[model samples]
Target: MVIKAQALAYFVVKCTFSGPQDLTLDEQLIRTPGIWKLFVDGSVAGKKCGAGLILSSPEGFEICQAIIFDFPLTNNETEYEVLLAGMKLARSLEAKHLRAFSNSMLVVKHFSGEYEQMDPQTTAYATKIKDASLSFGTFELSQIGRENNGWADALSRLASAKTQSLTGSIYLTEAKTPSIEKKECLEIRQGADWMTPLRNYLEKDILPPNRREELKIKYRASRSIIINGRMYHRSFSQPLLRCLNTEEQYQALEAVHEGICGEHLAGWSLAFKILRQGFFWPTLKVDASEYAKKCVQCQLFATVPRQPPEEMTSVLSPIQFAMWAVDIVGVLPTSTKQARYCIIAIDYMTKWVEARPLSAITEEAAKKFFIEQIILRFGIPKICISNNGTQFNGNKFRKFLHHFGFK
Candidate 1:
């Protein structure tokens, strides 16, 4: 067998302060008549500080040296992540017929079929360890009491000492701490300039001369420039401005402007130039109506229905959380005692009803009720059903749901 197994052997999983030299003498004993299992351990002490590990066979064949780092302000959860990272490295080395040992009862127990309440980070690490074990083909992990784990403890202390040495400079300097916000601010500013070249390209004459003149006329008329057969106007003003030299840019601008002769040219072209450079057309969510609306000929010829068809009316689904029915029952009489109206939310599943009384049947009052009363009580339903009531149709309510995590 490529891997020899001894019937009886001493397997010591130890945490120690003794360096690799301590294992040199024990090398052959580990490979002697019987087999030996060895585990070494250590822990980190400070910021960027970490523990270390040196695993050798019982007879002292070198296995691995691993480092475990810690952040001063971190919790057990973050420490667990560092531990898992260590295990993942070991697994990648393809250790087989192996045993794992740790001073961390939480880590050892959770890994060895012990069910203890673990934070999400630990839980995630445990899952990964199990997955790693399976990928390694065969392995066993066991926990040993500290008394039986002396060598590993010493090694953990050594690792802490090493970490202290490495991070010693950090202790002396106030500027050693990295700035997280500085990188973000740099990225934002750099991103703005990154688009500058693109803006110049657009302003420099990307548009055909004919299109530019058409756009100029549209600017004068305060209208959109729609080319020969397209629904959306291809903006030419900003494209024209990006091509301008510094003198042209300095003479005038609000994105676009009216000439002395009242002829329109690119004014706020500078802003438009930037915009054109950084332009990213959002992916439009298309409904059948939107496509039809965009068709100029169809839009002009299509007749509006006298009233919306009953079938076209949105109906709340039968599933409770699947959809919600909302409507403002209004035209309430103005009275101090009686509320002017109410916004009602009906659950499609439970058929439960929630109502918010409104003073003036105003959109604001209806919205406040929907948020404070309906959403707060029942949670945000996947879909909301509301009639063509002014309150429901207002832009505010749509923006509210969008701002929240809902979708």
Candidate 2:
């Protein structure tokens, strides 16, 4: 039984996660590793249910470990059974170890031996998975929230669409508010001279047609190119050709293209242009200063915007009695004649914070307040901290602390 269509529609909206700030600890641990993290997610496509598995790591990312295979038409149980097909495929990676985190508690628990299978169909899947895991390296299964499993879930739907050869489409719309003056961007000015070197390299050398067309499509074909008879577009050929010319220049260009260009360019058009001639000779090699200046885009866009220095925060770890961070939050609208200030104290180690509403922020008021409200409570916190302000630097405050046997 397949729940593919219904599952896909529900999965599209259901699997979206808010962001990293919202992910739980279990989800975080699964994603944080630099190595491979295999994600398996399921969706409903009409009566047929589909599952997707994606492998991601420092090596790069790939989709299509497995997708929807026609199952006996029924419910989510068959959907889940079919989903394990991806896990069986995962065994081919021969990963040193595996960490399987899923939003489906039923699947997670059954695999972890926390839940027993009540359904016979699921029982078979459970048994097969046990054998599959043993066939691979060591493995651990953990339960994660559906919200945290979004990326995998998305991949699953994509895989299913591909597997079934279904015409699935995704569209993005951007509405620009009319500007009084349109923003002008600096573009690479390519002349006839730019094509001369590339032509010489491609025609003179025994260049692969795929390679030649790749570079030509990338660097050349967009605006206008005159051929023998007809006019045609060579988009992919030019940019890819530029990449093949010099290995070092290609790498540097690829870095800028993937990093800076990829971020700013939205739909089809590119925001930044990398001219073949602009890439200098010494820029390709590792020289101290010239390499640095070669990235004009970085010079323009990559510099961190200057910020007013923040209130210096102490990195001193919280210790039992060593360092402290203290601050005051006040100007209370609730304050009356009885209380005009609030004294706050925090322990550097324990994260213990103390606060008191004061009648005044005077030297005597500060001393008397700390002695009664704080010093007596936690003994002496060794190091007291406050912003460089008049309330703490006053003479009576110094004398009051001295009289109390504190530095």
**Any idea how many clashes model 2 has?**
36
What TM-score, to 2 decimals, does candidate 2 have? 0.32
Best TM-score among the predictions, by candidate number: 2
How large an RMSD does model 1 have? 30.0
Q: lDDT at 124 for candidate 2?
A: 67
What would the per-residue lDDT of candidate 2 be over residues 233-318, giving only the tens digit for each residue? 23433432222224454464455445543443211122123333333321233331343445566467775757758766656754
Where model 2 places Cα greater than 4 Å from the true spot, the runs are: 1-22, 26-28, 31-35, 58-60, 64-66, 73-75, 158-407
Query: What local lDDT does model 2 show for residue 258?
Result: 51
Question: CA shift at 316, candidate 2, in angstroms?
Answer: 99
- Give lDDT: candidate 1, residue 85: 43
Task: Compute the lDDT for candidate 1.
Answer: 0.46
Q: Candidate 1's residue-wise lDDT over 1-407, tens digit each?
A: 11111111111233333423443233453344323244544444554333334454434444333333323424344335434444554544434445555556676778777777556656666666676566444455655555555544543443234222121111111112212223455556645442333333333433325767546543432322222111122345543112222333333331222223422222243233334542312111122224334445445655668975655855556656557777877667766767787778777877888876677776677668867877777677677767767776678867776765442
- Over 4 Å off, model 1: 1-48, 57-59, 64-86, 158-407
